[model samples]
Target: MLFNASQQWEKCVKQIEERDRLIFVSVYVLIFVAGLILNLIALVVFFFHTKTRSHTTVYMTNLAFADLCLVCTLPVRICYHLGVSLHQRLCEAMGMILLINMYGSIFLLSCTSVDRCVAVCFPMSSRVREVRKKAPFICLGVWIMTVGASLPIYFIKPQLPGYQNQSKCFGSFPVYGTRPVAITSSLTVGFGVPLLAMLVSSWGLLRAIKRSQAAQTDLVDSRKIQRMIAMCLVIFLCCFLPYHLSLLLVYLHQRSIPCSLTSSYNYSLMVACLNAMLDPLAYYFTTETFRKKVDLDALRQMWPMQSQSQSADHHSRGPLNT
Candidate 1:
């Protein structure tokens, strides 16, 4: 009987290794390379290259920083997948940084949407414009809060004694042996609330845009508003929904279900990290000033003489007016 049990355990371990190790390594490598490059570009462009300090720029700067922080954690994760053992404290710290930045990205992305919604809905309100100046402080608060919230997870260690290999890092962390509460709370706070906020802001933005269009309010840039709403909706659907659903499946698996979502969970997580790459696209496509600055910089670099000659001509061109 003992021999049979050991054989079954070895089979289970082999199956898991065969199913996930390659996938994890491949996905992490892709995300790490892509996300690292994209977020670094975004950080440089948004932080130092651009001259604008508008509300959109503020939130996007925060978002870029958040994504950069998250992408930095990928190497550690990839090292773990490649069979490099890490100290428990280092693993926990990496996990905390990942969660903190992931949630920070979610919040800042939502903030950018809200900023657009308010600007559109209250186009003539000086008060709304006044509140826009508070964006930096708001972004600071978000970073602090997310970091604080994720810190507790560092203390919630895994208890998978026999499955020691799986218990390291984020694979089987904050294990829900009997207490489902922790996972539920994390799901609600980390995923559900952010998603709901994005949906609400998007809906409100759409309504405001329509109303302003009907009233012929020229104060709001209808195109910009549409772009913000579209980006938020796409990120929520593509990056967030699948990962959180996989989390739900994982939770259900912990409750003794016969479902095998381990691969699903890992792949969905990779999908989530793709947001770090996709965000630069959002900045390029949706944020007009950022796009213009990037284009002008590219032109300047590619043709220094022509850019210097046309600098005065291009100086007065508004964002996306071209």
Candidate 2:
């Protein structure tokens, strides 16, 4: 009986390891490539090709920048999995950076949704200019808040028992212990609140759009509102939901639940990375000026000449669009 029980335990462990290997090799590879490419293109277009400097532009640009920062942290993760040497401090730092950008993206996404909701529901409000002017300040606050939230990593010593040489800095968290508090806090602030804000804003936007359509709004503007609502739903459902569900499973696992759900957590994290890739699609759909036709490749190819020409054009056209 004892011999048979040992065999069964070993089989279960082997299956988990095998499943995790497949997830890391397949899903993470797709995330790394697609996320990097899409985010880079978005940053380039937002930084260079776009002529408008509106509030939406500011929010989207910062969101893209945050996604790009998160994407930059993936190579370090891949290297750690591939047996590359990483100092403990470096590992901890990378973990903190990942959390910072993850929460930063969450807050920025919420801000964008709120901005759209206000714009649609109260377009003629006297405070429109005041709200628009606060966007940069709001972005700065998000950065500071996220950075402060991530600072606990500097003080918490990672406890990786038996596998001291392994680079599982964030992976070795004790589910039922202090780690759960951190994870719960992160999920609550980073995922839960933002998701609620998005849903409320999306519903508000939908009502506004419906009223406008009833009043015979422009076809173009109606389409933009519909697209924006769809994008927010996709981001919440496809990207954020799976990861947070996995975290819940981790909590259960910590409580001695004999489930094998932990092996799938990394796959959900990869799915979360898809949001970094998909956000540019949201930008393309939501904003009128962002959808304006511009040759990004041509602009990059002729950057030096184009910079001079655009400078002349800026002056000729009389001030940057704001």
User: For this target, which candidate reaches the highest lDDT against the unseen true structure?
Assistant: 1
Structural similarity to truth (TM-score) of each candidate: 0.75, 0.76
**The best candidate in terms of TM-score:** 2
Model 2 spans > 4 angstroms off: 1-17, 158-170, 174-184, 213-218, 221-224, 257-259, 289-322
What's the lDDT for residue 22 in model 1?
Answer: 79
Q: Would you list the C-alpha lDDT of every candidate in the order shown? A: 0.66, 0.64
Scanning candidate 2 in windows of ten residues, the lowest lDDT window is 293-302
TM match of model 1 to true structure = 0.75
lDDT of 1 at 29: 83
> Candidate 1 lDDT, tens digit per residue, 24-53?
788778877877888788778766877766
